[model samples]
Target chain A: MNEILKFFVNQDRMLGRNERNLMYTLKYNLKDSRAIADNKLFAKRIFKKNKLPIAKTLGVIRKKEDIESFDWSKLPESFVLKPNKGYAGGGIIVVYGEDKLHSKEGNRVWVKQNGVKIYQSDLEKHIIDILDNKYSLGGTKDKAFFEERLKLLKEFKLLTYKGIPDVRVIVFNKIPVMAMMRLPTVASSGKANITIGAIGVGIDIGSGVTTGGVYFNKPIEIHPDTKSKIVGFRVPYWDQILEISTKAQIASGLGLAGVDIALCRDHGPTILEINARPGLGIQIANNDSLKERLERVRKLKFKSIKHSIKLAKDLFGGEIEEEIEEITGKTVIGRYVNMNVEVRKKNLTVLAKVDTGADSTSIDSSLAREFGLLNSFDEFMEYYKTQKHESKNIESYHLESILDFANYRGIARVNNGNGTSIRPRFEVTIKIGNVKKKTIVNVIGREELKFQCIIGERDLNDFLVDVEKKI
Target chain B: MESFIQTAFVSNPTLFYYLLLIPVISSIIAMGRNVVGVKSYGFQTPMLIVFAFLNGSGGIEGSLFLIFVYLISFFLKTYTKSFNLHYLPRIAVIVSLISVIFLIYFMFFFKLVNISSISPIEMVIYISISEIFITSMFKSTGNKVAFLMFFNTLILSILAYIVVLFIPQWFLLRYPEIDILFIFITIAFSRWKHLRFNEMIRFRSVINDMDKE
Candidate 1:
């Protein structure tokens, strides 16, 4: 623990106590719950404003007068009664229709599929409890809001039990950092929170990329409740979602936050609530960390929303392959040597891969001879032919490489390590998926790895890669 | 270091009380992140008191004793609640009174006592203090709400502490696992979904299928 703290401190990349504490407090205090609570009132208002979409509010009830004098006929057969400040789906009564409702101690209450009805008196008791504010953020009194319940999206039916499906978009500095679609599980306290027991699907931060759905905190392809595979659902208006989340950061006076969005049949894109203190479950959903990604955002300077979104993508988007490349100081993702290894220096197309399986990225020993550091290896090799180093430093390389990498068109660089003891060949550039770049790499014997001028896994995944299947 | 562990696990007979905290902490983190409750102080403290009950009443036997405890405490709290007393002070008085009575009755009638050689007076004082905190919470809030959360903490902690008991490989690995469990629970709990027993109260209104009440 001391070492870990010292490492982060030595890097000087983390926020100080005041900012870190504020960021965390702001997550719980400034947003998430408050914004969700505000939704009780603003939900109807936002729907009136035509800001994307939301469930229409039938009414917001406070004391007895609100329920007694209100028009009962105006209510849809199926609607949701929720605590304006409720957390974790508390004090909520959902009616499938009139058949599912009953008069309990003089007031009508909603029922679930199992024929459980929340009586009006029970609602009153719950409301009184809320009024007592025992279950509020600061134990403050709250009201109850009634709204039309949303139908679960077809694509999400398997992921959800009976509640509406919600997608969480984590925003930092006005950009969407990580995104996951949370489906309600019976385990999640009857709501779609991943912590209690919900299924989370990692979406591509780019194009809302969705991958690796998990349940019960383990990698799982099928929903534990519904027994269906969770995959391949595209969120409409990906950019707009990020835009709304960014706009919410400004609206909520919070910088680091999450925006809960619901897709309605009529409303299209609805902002369910904004969460200030979003959980780290997002890391499991995305299989990454908010701590590290937030660190990147904290270091950046942006003038407007545009710069922020760009930084979000660069920092936390589907750039895992790229991050690994930068960290290992080796071009690992894209560059692979072939019968025709074409090296080009006129224009650098740098895409790297990450390979934890290998000890060191090996290039042609001739490349090391060019950098004049081959003697260092020889000196160490004289004592022992093999040496091991935990060198995870990034060093850039510019290589003049001619071409012929399996008929792919690109010049590349061999990204080198920071230490001077290791010599780097010229830069090798490999284009994986859509991204391309040049990087410095070390040159060594490939008799073991069996590929000439091959871009190590460290560099191959820097961008994205799809192996071209050909005849 | 020795004193802290001694206090947590050894030397202190009610170290089990602190042991109960592990599950409370886990459950609260679970509730806070996944359950999304406005209630913070969480269910752990009350749960600790509940564990003490099972411990004092001799495990399963104490569960039977809880019925009497509930009836008596409920009658008293009902009086205190209706009197419109300010929350904190009313709880303070009720807790003190309940602690005095329970300590006397439990020690004399149930013949239940915490066995520690340190000091009989200290043991008595400890139980008194513990009772004061639990009783005040019950008096301030209704016993039902306190117990609901208390039950939640107890259930979760029982499972968690039992699992933790099998771990630690003799204490060297114990401390780190606590922190790890904190982080792991934080991440895992982010995805929870389930219904609260409170929902059962809410659902009672809709149970009759429009049978003309």
Candidate 2:
């Protein structure tokens, strides 16, 4: 299939119009890729303008003098030091949790990629390589920057090594057409780009939802390090995230573009940078091709950017998740609790739970007196024979209520022959993980059952129980 | 990397096999570069040299196989000359037919073919060089072109052979990052276009002619 796909892709006729567009001269519109190429500071400028959140830049260290005069003390404890014009993820040092490399006799220190470290010595030798502009645009001399390291939200800590979470939005004509949430992996050495082992989670365009993520070119449902389920997540500020990304398409002047957005605590979303020839991995992550989606979007010229955004939402929004599943032909295993049951007369140890949120624990009326606890004779018979009929038994079984607190309030007067006639609350010792907790579980006999415990908010706070985890 | 550093000196047979493929892919990408200006096939000439070195005949038996390939390609190229096809097609028909001819020739005339008989695919690879040569026919103009191209390729092949033979693991480590053409790659290719060596060498006679005039 791959060989066949490659063959068709290279075929002139088989290629689409968007692909044909790729062969032509890049456009001279707003957010032009060349402009982005000419200036790195434009990304910073855009972030600052919209009140979008971004990391605080300590200094743009250019030349030896800038490096010398810049207060090294102004550098935040555990800040991100990086090359300003340096290529992607290159010339960056992240010292997490008060990191200062030790020299002989431990003098208090400041370090750059140069000045120390032989690994960086190769980088300096490679600086000649970078200055020769082997890695830069036209081999021009470069500048570097120092900025505060970002605090990753709780969702990303275990999944990323040293890298912060960043979202790549493919904005076409001032509308976000596609997106991928890239998380750093150990192999990426804490960088979010997936080429080096970071995971790319496909986001559902219709809903600001995440589907199963991928790593090492294979689709995965969980983070390898954190063991967190990798799908159905609400990316923060859904509409605003899309709005800012769309706004960037107007800013960058590149008609076909990729906008990288990073989150800040104070600022909502900041533009990381703009990419002209954004990677096809976004297509892979989003589970759709840019050619097809962009084709739909590229149609219908709009008078204003607002109409274009509305059109984008109409055309590409809902179909994103479905298209992703179609392209990959795989099911996203969501973090859901499920079970299979054999419905019959069986000794099924129906695991039960209790919630103090309920006023009383109800049992099958047949066990009322069998466990040596007396109940009014008339009330027990009436409750078991006809459950829907509600009657007050203040003199008899006033303490116990037969009301089913499962969904909408209802009555369940269930009984089996083996159940105790006296419905006495049994002290159930349910073991969950390494922790043991005690609960009052009513031994109920019924035709069938779903969940044994309601586990309302009241009793849940004590054991810190996860209903998904069971013995 | 430690293991790669250790394997670097060994020159294993598998390394040669994998190394042989680099040229094949690079060849395809080189075609892409010339046609599309994608710059995907950076360092193409070196890659082709590497390919040829790894695939070339090594010893006396290997030489005899080479002779068989030459004999087969020569006959097919001649036999297919009357066909209406272009140079490449002519070469292709000849190359395909050469495989059968070599197999037949070996069966009738010699026991020198390896494993008591040359494998069909091996014969195909040997004959395929005729197609490469046919492409080269359009590569340049004037007398001594073929000879110049041939010798240049030969030297490159030898250098590629030495590199592949001595530092097989070095190429393996570095090879995956090949075919990456970024803004950086564009920057590099642009530089390569302005190269002075190829310009001076290719137009030496023209310069001499102009000087004489």
Candidate 3:
């Protein structure tokens, strides 16, 4: 934690709350209000004017008279109805196709993407609600508009629960700083809102491939419902997506903006909305802070949107992969490696099995006791109890620091040959094939088991596993 | 002009004293909003001034009334989960419930406590407190946030009250035109794009880094 603080201090890359406010006050002009707030319709007009690809606007019902005079038959079979000033994903209705039985009543009924039937009257009432500004940011009167319902790309069909998934790209000074793909879930009620339980999968800004996913603010690998892997899912047309987002930022004229894009199976990626004050949830999704990214690009000059897009890709793209390689070096190891494991302040050389199946490394409890880690664990527990009594609860970060001192890191329920039992994890230093690293290893009652230690994939990321080679 | 100022100050010293808090309270709200990243309604300043004035006028009873109103409104908002009524109507119902509670308190408890010093202005202030409470309840997303906002507002009002009460009346009287300086100060505050004091601590690492660089 101190190192992270020192790193941020040394880098001077952390953007504070005041910096954000000052950036908005100094960089974002008052005239840019239309580009930033309650101006999705205005933003759409700007997109149309700039010849940017966007969902076609069938019609806009600004007032009651417009709603009455609007011809529902002229609308597309599948379309989206949304309020221009609607904040987040509120006041959005996605229609899949026109219901044939209700079409006899002259385009009065429609089928929702989630298979719910909606009548024309229900839509009109929703439009009335939109006009009432029920879903608007400030509850000001709003305009309801019909837009082309972009078909979900095949790659995202299995990943998204029911609603359309959209990618949010945070563009700062015409450069794309960060991007996250928001997937709708049943909990979010078909809306890609992180606060409402939509999955926020962080996309590699450079490569446009998903690096990680966070659901309900917790790191997750797969869709909770669909069970499809979210990480490493390469977003199609990455460069084009970045290009369009940059164009939207340039067109919007807001120095800081969030450009939302959705991929249409036929039309490719289309700009959905450009938010002036985009949310900070993308930070958690990417497991990276926005301050460093914003600070990196805030001062740079860009001749064109294309140039900026390329720069963003070059600078931020494939960072995770590079970081892995830098930390691990180009070392390769066999499936089984003879390693000197240090625990309880004692060292023992043991033949450790390298298993990718385990999420973490594990060590035998007897070996852990021999190293005096078990005694340290008891001391740590006493300290933790006193701290908890004093502070009511220890912060996760502080708890981590305490664990670090105690040489105990985590607790996990491990399934062994006998049964599943809870085990305490201890921090151990291991030297395998000349590469020495410190990692947390779960201490289990593995006295009955053959191998005293098992090194998992997490510890093995730095080394390529060669099953046939003997080390 | 001096005589006129003295007469005006003498006529209503409390109002004059509390009026000076307007700019101070406004600056506090502005700084608080910038630090917390929450939007401040236009009425928040006036609400604080009124709260401070009422507390000054009726003392403990006035503060108790405000606290009771806020608690009732917060509880009503939290417990009534399925009340899918419209925003205006929902606020109206909560306000009505608060009014009833106040009425009951005045009718039964007021006689027993015999705190007859409560002025008509204090009553009006108590009523206005409900409006601000309801508005805040509506604006905030959760009960905890609503309570926090209320607490922040309360703390600021109390601070303003302290400033108004403790500051020498003679100093204010002699420097009557100092109020104009407050307006200019407010304008400067509005244009202040610098990092807030809290932000300095929040981004201390960056500041420390800049210092080293």
Winning candidate number (DockQ): 3
* Residue B11 accuracy (lDDT) in model 1: 51
Chain B fold agreement for model 3, TM-score:
0.74
TM-score of chain B of 1: 0.47
State how far residue A169 of model 2 sits from its true place (Å): 0.4
Q: Write the per-residue lDDT of candidate 1 for residues A280-359, one digit (tens) a residue.
A: 55655665545556766665666787777766666556553343233233322222322122254333222223343443
Fnat for candidate 3 (0 to 1): 0.20
Tens digit per residue, CA lDDT, model 3, A1-471: 976576544433444445555565256634655435457788888898998898988899999899779998788778999988887677788999888875755447889977989888778877876776666777676789998888888989878888778999998888999999999887777778886789999888876767777786667867888887676667888888899988888888777878899998989999988877677667667756677788788789889877898889887776555432332353556678898987556778999899878888888766776776664445445555566445423455556443443675556777867787666777778988778888888876546757888888778755655454577
Fnat scores for every prediction: 0.00, 0.00, 0.20
Q: How does candidate 1 fare on TM-score?
A: 0.49
Q: Write the number of the candidate with greater DockQ, choosing between 2 and 3.
A: 3
Ranking by lDDT: 3, 1, 2
Clashes of 3: 2
Q: After superposition, how far is residue A466 of candidate 1 from its true place, in Å?
A: 13
lDDT of 3: 0.71
| Candidate 2, B144-207: lDDT as tens digits | 4433554454444444455456545456455534424333444443333221333223223223
TM-score of 3: 0.65
Q: What is each model's TM-score for chain A?
A: 0.58, 0.63, 0.66
